[model samples]
Target: VTVCCVAADPPAEAWVKGGPVDPNLLGATTRSFLAKVLTSLMDRFEQDDDKDTVAAAGEALAQLAMLLGGPGVHSVTQRLIDTCLQLLQQEHICQSSDDELDGEEDHDGALWEAVSELLM
Candidate 1:
């Protein structure tokens, strides 16, 4: 399945002459395959109605961050931050009360911690 694909190493035949070549029969590189997996997980995190499934997706994201290393994790987190910041800057985020701001702060704090851990 997708998880197995994401966890797999790229095939030896996937590279040639010290460069990436089309390994048509072989599959995608780890990074490329995992990107799809991460995107699917993120989509499910937002769209899934089942609490357990959503929770698992969230955990999967943390595990993926660990697997991806600093630069890759930064790429993922930066996309998240950019999306959130865009919502805030574009006034897409509703500020109905003080509680909303508090919630936003909580999310921001957690995101910062995740990024810091990835960097370290």
Candidate 2:
């Protein structure tokens, strides 16, 4: 899954190289491919317990969300938000104090921050 995330970055960077995206640049086949890859990443994110795996999947989904748009795209955005919220909920269970989070907590927090940045 980490490999998938690593693999996603370059193309994502290329796709968003210009300031604003023109959706027509992504044709039907490209959109379909992205949808498949995004779905796979989301699934991996939900199933993985390893922090690195989860973080990678989260990052990849965030990048993909930056490209996916138009009429049916709200479903994708909603699903991504739901997934991030679910991750936050799970992280919340581990919180015991306001200022005593450890390394794992930091990782989860950072991942949440990244997701938040993407959503906004």
Candidate 3:
């Protein structure tokens, strides 16, 4: 989690312009770091059964996408949407009358929330 947070918010000096830049336009070092961070977060988001952890990864991915504002944003957005849709198709997300979810259901809800944040 710490690694993801740090990766999402790279050091100011890591950027070619002292701030966020398009991943494709980044230097080799920054590009490598970005790839590793994206892979790790995607892996966690896809494989983790823990709702909180998955949500965190999703949020990190969103943050990274925002940081790298370019054509990469479209790819990341598509991947997130596809993953969320796959999860929805594989499981039946249900909510109780009290607007609460449990166990696996909570995972889906949290993921949707993260995706919503990403889209916004």
In order of appearance, the predictions have TM-scores of: 0.41, 0.56, 0.56
How does candidate 3 score on lDDT? 0.58
TM-score of 1: 0.41
Q: In candidate 2, which residue ranges exceed 4 Å CA deviation?
A: 1-26, 70-75, 91-102
Candidate with the larger TM-score of 2 and 3:
3
Candidate 2 residue pairs in clash (backbone atoms < 3 Å): none
Model 3: what TM-score?
Answer: 0.56
Write candidate 3's Cα lDDT for 1-120 as tens digits.
434544665544443323444454544554556666777787776667556777788788777665554423433556667666655565412211234445656666776787676665
* Superposition error at 34 for model 1 (Å): 1.8
Task: Compose the digit string of candidate 1's lDDT tens values, residues 1-120.
Answer: 534653575344433232433333234566566556767876754455433454455556666554443323344566545533533453222222235443566554554444344334
Runs in model 1 deviating more than 4 A are 1-28, 78-120
lDDT of 1 at 44: 57
Question: In terms of TM-score, how similar is model 2 to the real structure?
Answer: 0.56
* Regions of model 3 farther than 4 Å from truth: 1-23, 71-78, 88-109
Clashing pairs in 1: none
- What does candidate 2's lDDT look like per residue over 30-83, in tens digits? 555665676777676666655556677777666555544332133366666676
